[model samples]
Target: MNEQYPVLPGAEPFYAENGPAGVLLVHGFTGTPHSMRPLAEAYAKAGYTVCLPRLKGHGTHYEDMERTTFRDWIDSVEEGYEWLKERCGTIFVTGLSMGGTLTLYMAERYPSIRGIVLINPAIDIPAIRAGLAAGDELPRYLDSIGSDLKNPDVKELAYEKTPTASLLQLARLMEQVKGELERVACPILIFVSNEDHVVPPENADIIFRGVRSSDKEIVRLKNSYHVATLDHDQPLVIERSLRFFAKHSK
Candidate 1:
């Protein structure tokens, strides 16, 4: 059952070391670390150790993704965190979409996170539950969730199709994370696109209202869509995140 899919060049895990401040970048479901490469490079150049690991079933074929569970995805983030912990004195985490979900999960599970930044982090999207309810009635896969950027020239290197089983698992994960949002007390910065097609904008409100963090702010992206990491507001995300990290750094 090794179905082959086109693996895009440069769509692989990335890492760099420059200083004691470590930053972990996590990509979304069906997405490769390539989506976060520019951000990672920016952080590295700014004198921070950056680690972006390809999540368990992502950056490969859709068939491989179908075989992965949410636990497997989070495990990859944990591994990346451990790797960064070994090289730096302080750590920050940021993610996009499902990556953001894992970032919140990590922030709650590990109190060592100095700060948190999330771009369109998925929590309880209605489509996810709808798709899960439909279950096996739907095809093994659906249209790709990639390339949600409003900048038509920019394309995300992600699967062309979405796996149904994995989507169900993701729905479950979202529910679980929402329940534990109170545990995420780290300083947080969140970016939400007002015109996102893949994830509803309300998800951001849910997070902002649920988290118990004393220092948390939400920035609405006026020009970008779901994949704001590679969109027009990318600079804003990077700049604000760097500031947030610096403000909370030890």
Candidate 2:
């Protein structure tokens, strides 16, 4: 299945010179590196060495997702960041949804990170809060749903059923990331959709308020859905992300 998925045009042998700066892009849960391929390519084209690492159990069988944990996701991002750090003078991390959360975790753990960009970061799971309160009920329901499923989009990609355990672990990680937000001092650019039906817009608000970074901005995408990366507002996302990268890369 991994071989069936399209690889990014210049994704392999990730190397670049005189690039904008090193960029580490992480994709959302149940998503592959494909989600961030365009942005990665854009950064590379703009002269930045970009690394988009496939998270644990991703880009493969749906069942592989069930066996992974949030720690594994964070570790993958860390590894990518380390790879970028060696080649570039500065480093910026970006993510979508769960990817966003992992970016925040990286920021908290690595002070050298120059900046961060988050698209609809999942800081809390309001939809499953009650079930979580009921002691494993949410995990049970999510396990039934599988990791491959996702909200409908005009340019829908294949999604596996979400694993219950993985989602519950994500919820826990969100809480942990929320608590660690105060430790993130890097410049940040966060994007949110006014009409997003998945992660709540409030998640953005909490991040905007909690991040200790003196340089932080949030842009609200009025016409976008949950997956703003591929939605009509994608141009704005790319533009803003580049702008943010340029600002901090200096």
Candidate 3:
């Protein structure tokens, strides 16, 4: 919701001009930057320049997502990373769900990334893979997968209906990302929800085992669900991430 483009209320991408050290926060598929806004603000508060970009085809409407692909979403993240790289000598990347996937993608390509943080990164979802394997004509829209927060009071500003074709791209992205996990050598701090209903908890294990980052830690979120960033353990997530960034950014 910044000056770059129009977005729904609370969905605008935000940038904080703070320092030579920056953090780029990416949101998940079918999700707007609102999901990652809290974390972005947290990073900004710590005097780190922060960019939380609204992925293409998101933060507007589900129908808009139909015209997009995973590559488009990736391009959005790359743009944000470039913004940070231009201004910040030390850059860190962090994401949630597919955002985390993109974060890993960034590390795979840019070995200069100081560190990374992931919340419920979705690498391999079996149901999505099977659906792609079927090759059957899929419905144009399906039930929403957003707002999977453990706290009933808070809700994620995600799409109400998921574009079916996007799932295929997600599967493709996962395949592409998981194959290059060994190339992600940046220090990583991963958060996994123990009771997530969206992406399986096994994803954490896969990432932990797959990433070549000798400096990696996986913390289980027992008090949260899929969107742990807005869940009960959010404070913990923010605190741990700040510590991780500080440790590596130095």
- Candidate 1 lDDT tens digits, 62-81: 88899888989988999999
Clashing pairs in 1: none
Give me the runs in candidate 1 sitting further than 4 Å from their true place: 1-7
Best by lDDT: 3
**Candidate 3 per-residue lDDT over residues 1-250, each given as its tens digit:** 2233356899899999998899999999888888888889999999999999889889888777877888998899999999988889999999999999999999999999999999999999998877767776677788999999999999999999998888888988999999999999989999999999899999999999999989999999889999998899999999999999888877
Q: What is the lDDT of residue 230 in candidate 2?
A: 71
User: Which has the higher lDDT value, candidate number 2 or candidate number 3?
Assistant: 3
Could you tell me the lDDT of residue 93 within candidate 1? 97
**lDDT (Cα) of model 3:** 0.91
Candidate 2 per-residue lDDT, tens place, 138-244, comes to 44334322122133444433244666666777888898999989999999999998876668889999999999999899999886777777777778999889988
lDDT of each: 0.90, 0.77, 0.91
Compared with the true structure, model 2 gives a TM-score of 0.87
Shift of residue 19 alpha carbon in model 3, Å:
1.6
